[model samples]
Target: MLAHHTLTGPEDAPVLVLGNALGTTTDLWSDFSLPFRLLRFDHRGHGLSPAIDGPCTIADLAGDVVELLDHLELRQVYYCGVSLGGMVGMWLAAHTDRISRLALVCTTAWVPDKGRLDERIAQLRSSGMESVADTIMSRWFTPLCPPDAVARFRAELLNVDLPTYLACVEAVREMDLRADLVKIDVPTVVIAAAQDHATPTELVRQTADELPDSELYVVGDAAHLAVVEAPRTISVILDDHFGNDLT
Candidate 1:
C-alpha cells in the first residue's frame, strides 16, 4: 500500500484525496488548505512507498490508489492530482465510482512527448536523478520559484529509487488517455499552468474540452508544478470546484 497521511476534519466531511506529481511526495501538498478530510499519499515507487522493479502502466498506478482508498475504508473521495497524479486521477474518475469529483492540475490526456520521455529515461538510467535535475526544474517552475521549494523538490528527486522511478517514467511514456476522457462522468476541473512546458497549455486545454463535465482554469506565471508554484491560486480553484456540497 502507498504511504498515506490523513488530515482529520469534521465527522461527516467528504474526503479529499491529494495525489502527488511524478517525482515528489505528499509534501508536494504541504501548504494546501481546505475544509475537508484530506488524504495524501506517495505513489507506488515514490516517497516512502514500496518500489517496483520495472515498467508499469498508468492503470497500474491507479490501481494502487484504489487499494489505498479501500485499505483506508473510504467509500468515496474528491480527488486531485498534478501531472502524473492527474493522469491517474483521470483514470480513476473515468473507470470507477470512487472519485466523486476530480481536479486535474497541470495534467494531460496523453503523453505528447514520447521522444523527450525516451531521452529522460536514458539520462536517468545513466546518471540517476541528478542527471536531469536542472532541465526538470527549469520546466517544473517559472523564474518565480523560490530557492527553498526548489531545494526541497530537488531532495525529493534525489531520494527516488532508480528502478521505481524509471518504471513511472515508462508509464508516462506509454500513457494515451484521450480516448478514455469521454468516459469520465463526474464533475472535473482541469487546471493549466500558463508557463508549463512539461504538459503545455494546449494539452491541458484539450483535456478540459474532452471531459463531458469539466471546468477549465489557467494560472498565469506558473509552470509544471503549478500547485507548488502557485499554491494560493490552485487552492482557491480547488476550493471553488471541489468545496461545494456535492458529497
Candidate 2:
C-alpha cells in the first residue's frame, strides 16, 4: 500500500496537492503549504517512504498518486507538480479528470539529457544516495544565488532515496505528452524559470502553445528550482492562478 502524508487545512478550502521533483521530499513544496492545504509526502520510495523493490515507471508514480488522492477522499484537486512531479500530474490528468487545475513548474515533458540521466541513476543505486546527490543538486540552480539557498537545496536533495531518485529520472526521460496535451481539458499553468538549465524557456513556451487555457510565467532571476528560490513571487502567482479565489 502507498501511504501519503497529507496537509489538513480548511474542509471547504480548495484542495491543493503538491508533488516534488524526484530525489527530494515534499519539502520541495514547503513554500506552497503556508497558504493552502498541502498534500506533501514522499513518492513510493522517496523521502520517508520505505524503498521497495519493483518496476518504478511513470505509470507507477501516477498510480501511487491515485491511491493518495483516494486515501485523502478528495474527489477533485488542483495538482502542483515540479519536474518529476509535473510529469506525474500530466500522466494523471491524461488518464482521468480528477485534477481540477494543473500547475507544472520547472519541469518538461521529457528530460533533455538521457545519457546523463541513466548514468546518474546507476550511480545513485550502486554508489548510494550521498555519492551522486551532491553532483545532482548542483544542477538544481544556476550560478547566481546566495550561498545559503544553494546549501539548503543540496542538503534536502541528498536525503532522497537513490533507487527512487533513479526511477523518477526515467519518468522524466520517457514522458512525451505532446499528443496528450490537446486532450487536457483543465485550467493549466506552466511556470518556467528564466535561467533554468533543466527546462529552457523555449520548451516551456512550446508546452504552453499546446494547451488551451494555459498561462506561462518566467520567474525572474531564478533557475530550475524557481519556486523555492523565489517563493513569494511563485506564491502570489499561484494564488492568482490556481487558488480558490480564482474559482
Q: Candidate 1 residues 1-247, lDDT tens each?
A: 5555555666677889898899999999888888778888888777788888767899999999898888889888999999999999999988889998999999998876699999999999888889899899998988879988998998898888888889998888888899989999999999998999999899899899999999999999799999888899988888888877554
lDDT tens readout by residue for model 2, 98-165: 89899988877665568877887678678777787556656677667677867776777776555666
In terms of lDDT, the poorest run of 10 residues in model 1 is: 1-10
Best by lDDT: 1
Misplaced by over 4 Å in model 2 are 33-35, 244-247
**Residue 82, model 1, lDDT:** 93
Q: What is the C-alpha lDDT of each candidate?
A: 0.88, 0.77
Positional deviation of residue 220's Cα in model 1 after best superposition, in angstroms: 0.4
